[model samples]
Target chain A: MPKTLEIRKLHVEIEGREIIKGVDLTVSTGEIHAIMGPNGSGKSTLSYSILGHPDYAVTQGEVLFDGENVLDMKPDERAAKGLFLAFQYPVEVPGVTLASFLRTAVNSIRKKQARWGGQPLKEISAIEFYKRLEEKMNLLQMDPSFAQRYLNEGFSGGEKKRAEILQMAMLGPSIAILDETDSGLDIDALRIVSDGVNALYGPDVGLLVITHYQRILRYVQPQFVHVLVDGRIALSGGPELAEQLEEHGYDWVKDQLGESAVTRQNG
Target chain B: MANALNFNRREGYLEKYGFHDKNSYVYRTEKGVSSRIVEEISGLKGEPEWMRNFRLRSYGIFEKKSMPGWGADLSGLRFDDLYYYVKPSDKKGRNWDEVPEKVKLTFERLGIPEAERKYLAGVEAQYDSESVYSSLKGIWEKLGVIFCSTDEALKKYPDIVRQYFGTVIPPGDNKFAALNSAVWSGGSFIYVPAGVKVEIPLQAYFRINAESAGQFERTLIIAEPGSFVHYVEGCTAPVYSTNSLHSAVVEIVVKEGARVRYTSIQNWSDNVYNLVTKRAFAYKDATMEWLDGNLGSKVTMKYPSIYLMEKGARGEVLSIAYAGNGQHQDAGGKAVHIAPYTSSRIVSKSISKGTGRSSYRGLVHVRKGAHHVKSKVRCDALLLDDRARSDTYPVMEINEDEVDIGHEATVSKVGDEQLFYLTSRGLTEEEATAVIVSGFIEPIVKQLPMEYAIELNRLIELEMEGSVG
Candidate 1:
């Protein structure tokens, strides 16, 4: 059976304000989906809620991973269950080297897998772990020095995004939600990050590329595109939907959904 | 989910250093302190007349002085209930084999013998209130280096002991110092001759096993002109329902152009009150460094001090204090510059979790004629939860105009975003908090030796277990 993430009628709130109102989505392995929306359309809220962020409250929803409810799980448990979310802004964890952090995450996931009933796997040795990390960094076109540098501390915007991609490559998640990974990247960086993401896409992994523009989709094309407006998906179509949104901007979706439906109180 | 920050369980410490051996001492003075008790202790050691008189005088001063009014609360300290002196053995063991079976087994459990074999140049294992075992490399001894217990030094090197004993920190310096002066025993007494550099660190391990015991060990290090030495000390005690007292006085004399580094990793059990006084004097062109790491103790009030007594002297202090669950660590460093062209740096890092509290109490003083002096003080604290607390009280007394001084302090609670980020990468909550804390203190940890650095990080991880709800 394929790995599946089923988000059904997910009503999410942040500090008592409804952001994701009755949104329903499902993603499975080997498929690509893009969630596009304007600033307050609840695109980020949806991604955070799916990953079990504490600040994002799911008021009335059931997030099922492979048919099991995941809303009650901690963020770490969600990650252990093969879910990954690339943040819009990766936090700087000073003094913890990138290589050490990635190794720890890898070992933790490995231990969780052993507990969840696969072959009882041993932890990756430092030498072997570093060798694999170097390979991933090389594929991402990242500087090898980054392995010794503190995680995202004083890193450039493009470097941070590439590090997020590197982490995804190392974790080998079944489902990865890239939240605005292309937001702060330059054209060259977007190409490298897109190439890294494209490499990770295969029959064993799923990609949910959340972006505001079609620039990243131009390189790493998604099979499905959903235009989110006012905490709800207003349109779902092929990859051309993203091209239409970029060509006409989010106003076209708002116009299609009607002014009253798209006009939120803050907006 | 609402209460994310909860108290940390200390069963790790209880398993690691909380086991007590049976009290098998050769002798112990009656409980409480008096001039007669002090005289009895000195007579037991068979000290010279002047030294016995010094102990009596110190007892008088300890009687006159009062408990410290500032820093962590010391009202819980019951001096009258504590045994003033405990002799674990009649004489010091010259080797590990000569040490009593029970005492040697305790040090073996603590890994003291293995450490001495691997990297230490000398080892002093003090059980209860006496030195049970001592060993120094023959190479160091051939270079006129003397590494022995303070009691042995008073007998073999009486002239040198009388010259420098209490010279740096006098008997009447403070209440705890006065008490240590009166009932001090079993601490390291080291001497390095001129131009000799004992490359490897000399280590001392102090252990307190008896209940309501007062272990007052006095350590004195004299680095002759152009000589260098690094001395490391570690301490632990068994957990008891009633509290114990560990008040030590350490004084170092760095002569002209000499350098000395003293590193102490104090891990007394939570039932111990670790109030210690440590000070040093750096002569012309000399250097002194104090690395103090405190991870255990119910209440600790220690501020290692350094006095730049001559031109071109330098001093540096790097301290780490971890306060977890009912522990209060009041630790920092002080630098007094009385000579020109002196420089000093003090960096303090602390972590507080549960109901624990940590405070950085420091002072930097530059006298009127001490021109061209420089100093810097940086204190950083990490609180794992809202209930944990940290305080910084820095004093700067600069009467000299031609001096450069700087002080910086930062207090940060482990942010929810940071924790979530680490957890999102698959680390558990406790592991995430430990990672953040280890990162916070990495600067000071990096300054320690390889083995010590690893041990410190491991100790921090143990303390961080079950810190989050």
Candidate 2:
């Protein structure tokens, strides 16, 4: 059976404020879902809540990835379970290099992949890992010198986003979330980044592409599109919904469900 | 080695070299610090009128000052019994071959003169109370730079000493500073001329081969306008049954548009009271950097400070300390901005293992006249086991509104999984913890010179031995 991520009525809270309230999401292989939202609409919160960031408390829901309870797993364990979230503003870890960090994360995912197989993967050699990394860098037009530099230390916005996709490519996660990957990129950088995402969109990997614009979706086509207003998915439909919503704007949904009423009902 | 073993069974490691044996030396002081001992120390060093009067005035200040209650415990320090001075054999050795066999063996054990011959651009090796050998290479002297003991500077550059000494940090600044001024001996005196940058670092190694004796060294470094230099100070005291005292003072004056980097790696015997005062003054467009490492001491109270006195000046202090059983490492940094547009940063990393305690007490003060000054302070402490403890106390007094300041502190231990992961990769428990500790201290290690960084790693490994099963 093809592995899938089923989020059945998941609600998340930090302190007392609800961020992801009753969010129902299903992501399957060979499909890319584009989630568009206004600012402070809890779009990033949902990504963090799913990846098991310690701050977000899962109030009353079950996130089932391959039929396993994901809330009970640690962050690294969730990462090991083929779940990757490319942070919007990637943190700079001073002493940890991209190559060393990727080596550890890749080997961790390899260990997870070995349990169900008849034979172990015998941990990829350093040379093999370097070869794959070099190839992925070329696809994204990323400088190979970045692999030795400290992770995201003094990188520009476009460079950081490219590095994030590079990680997704090297680790080969089953389900990956790219949060605001096109926030601060120029038109040329936007095309290069979309191509990198398109190259990785295959039957083996499912993607949740989160952004606030409809421009990136034009390049990397999504099979499903959802508009997040407040904390709930107020409008969800096929790929055409993105173009409609982008043209007509989010007020139509806000008016259909009264402004404060829909906000309180979902927020 | 025979004389070492036969010297005294009670004194550990560097047994025979200690000055505690009453009959071991000639022309020593009686019990306490009165006018008599002060005069004895001065008269023994061969009296000059101005130097004698300077020590007398400092002795009065040391008497009036009381012990500070802030940092390390000073209750165990027996000021009356500590031998103020030991000649360490009669005369200073003019050459390497002339040094006495006992003192020579002590340097051999420490690998001192050999290290100087290889890596250091210049060297000063101080044994007990005086500089036994100081042969700075000709490359430095040819540049019109002064690299010699404080005593030499006192005689050769008296006017230079009179103009700058106690100007940045006077004798009355603190208790330890007053004590150091009273009986200071055998430390570096450097003066780099304007616009002359020294590529190779100058270094001094102070080894206390004598027991129960106080070695009070004073280091003074002055970089003229637009010049640069890096000075390193290292200390290691031989173990003893009774405690010894090492109260040194280091004062640096970086002139306008100059820079000076001072690095220290301290590994004293657990019975020694490692109390020292260090301060630097940076003028307009100048910079000062301090890289301090504290490994062994019963009670150490040191905070290397910088006073930014002009606009566009910079200061940085990078320190790492490892405290094991029966030790307390109370150290931090202080930066005071007296002018506008000055900036500073303090990054301290400490590891407390096996009932040891490490605390980071620091301050970033900006005066009202100092506007638009920016500073950031980050302190990280790693406690190894249940018995260890760590604390961070940061105080920032910002009088100006146009400034940026950030402070962060993290306290973590060796996670079970981080250790398990390493051991599963075919390393032993010791090797795994060694790697983690090395990684923990990587930020500071990367800033050190190549040879010193490797030596520090090996030293940390040696300290970790027998710490775990």
Candidate 3:
């Protein structure tokens, strides 16, 4: 089941600079949450912190992915636990093909689960896997030929995001974090990627969409919208908050919680 | 303790690669190379004007060159005691059954026959001085692709052989290159036609079947314009009471829009000195990739390198080495960007155990005119035992300001967490170590042709068997 991805007093530091400071948010199963803010508002850091990115260290706080603290786990471990972070800039692993990488990542999760005293896993053969992968690629509107290509190598902006969604579809993680996947996308590609995410969105999977604009939010409606400013949640409301923030800009939140006050709250 | 030690020792890649019995070589030259033997080898190989001239010219270069003062020390090399060229057997055989008993028995243990039956487009089995089996069947040979021994290439296709043999790596390039050129014998010579892509991999296996011998091989691979070829070399030397020398020179040329992947998995014995030189050149829009693995040997100095000669060209080197006991593997890569928009990468991984020493020495150079050139170099080393040593010396000569270059290296031991993760999965100490070691070298291993890759995995596992604490 898609348990709530709850962040409580979450503090994170990237390269010794405290980025995500005292942030609190909750998204239930079947709910879509969006975090929007300015350039240095720690939106991406929050997503990275929750997914246990090696750079973003959780100095003090807890991210509960299904009531279990994710800080103690490695990035791959968190990923295996159905915690997915669609990177703002997906890494390019040149030699590993998309198929082999996904297969290995999935199999690693299965193998890790086997190590965790979980039930044994039976992996599908390549023939069966290719059929399913082709379907997922079609669902994501990805060209089928990309399946054999190297993971994210020389991929366009839209294709990289689609590949990320394809990985999410294959892994079928419980909580999906899309970190600015909407950036550099033509509206058509934005719709296709958002639709792909929406198609993956069900009661069993929760969604956390971080964006610089509400363009993607228009396609995938969010039940919860939080304004992240200066590393903390400055404003929290329903999807209407996104519309309001988009219209008024983060200026409304900036007025209430200025720079000094924000740092003080962080401290 | 005796029973435990036996079990541990049986678990290493050493046994798989070291299964051959020691045999006394017919003859050996002095410790270092010289000019007289160059004439002797030319006379022995039976005589050709151009061939003899190349050797004599290369011998001149060798005489003029000095031993390299960097990387691994070659002070202990006894060139006269090394059999420069040893054809202990009669002639090159085309089948396994026809091969000499010693050569056949050696590869039988290394699983060459099985790999030939299953994977491999063609297998060139070279035991010490010459190939015992060189076979490329119907469509492959019909494709106008010449996949044969270097000696055969010199005799059969002299024009192609003389044209690009020393272009990428000339005899005067380095001391070892000159040495290899003077008395080079068994090695691969592949020429894929333009627009031809060899789907299956072509492999060459080199074995040091003699004690106190030297293997000087010159491999020339030319992937013509728009063509592609993946050539792999697997080597293993038998344990000898005395030291030996395995010096090789490999030159690969990737013509315009062509691609060439060269992979090597070398695990020589503890007494062998493996000093090899490998270099490749990539033209406009071409790509060259080198995947080299170094395991055994008392001391080794090898750098499988590439030169991006034209614009929009790319070069990459992924290398992994494991040094155990009295071994010292000094291996890395080099990349030179001569034209605009050239990209290159150098990744080196190594593990040192027992009293072994491993070092990653590399250079990445971008010429003044090379604009928009991108390069990244990463070297990581792991020490498995207390007395083990690992070092990295990387030199980046960047004359171009428009290029982007990044270099990072890490040196550490096997982490307790990684071992615990594998051990907790029900693997014993050796199994856990084997898994982690293979994973550490997975980047380079993945590039090998599947059969050789599996054999390499097995060989590494065998080598690490008794190594764990």
Better of 1 and 2 by DockQ: 1
Compare the candidates by DockQ and give the number of the best one. Answer: 1
Instruction: For model 3 chain B, give the 10-residue run with minimal summed lDDT.
Output: B115-124
True contacts kept of 1: 0.76
List ranges where model 2 is wrong by over 4 Å.
A1-267, B1-27, B90-113, B116-136, B205-214, B235-243
lDDT tens digits, residue span A179-258, model 3 = 89999899999889988999999999888999989889999999888888889888888888888877888887787667
Measured against the native two-chain assembly using Cα atoms, what DockQ does each of the candidate structures obtain, in the order listed?
Answer: 0.77, 0.04, 0.03
TM-score of chain A of each: 0.95, 0.93, 0.93
Predict model 3's lDDT versus the native: 0.76
| Position B371, candidate 2: lDDT | 87
Ranking by lDDT: 1, 2, 3
For candidate 1, the per-residue lDDT at A56 reads: 92
Over B1-469, each residue of candidate 3 has an lDDT whose tens digit, in order, gives 1232233332343443342223424444544456777778788778588778888899899888998878887788766676676654332223444434544444454555553421121112433223333334355777988877787777899899989878888889887788888888878889999999988677664222221123777788999999998877764323322337888888899999999998777767677788898989899999999998887788989888888999989999999888887789999999988898999999999988888899999999999899999999999887887899999989999998998899999886666544432332223456556655665676777767676777777767656666786
lDDT for position B245 in model 3: 81
Off by over 4 Å in 3: A1-267, B1-33, B91-136, B205-214, B235-243
- Alpha carbon lDDT at A37, candidate 1: 91
Mark the 10 consecutive residues where model 1 chain A has the least summed lDDT.
A257-266
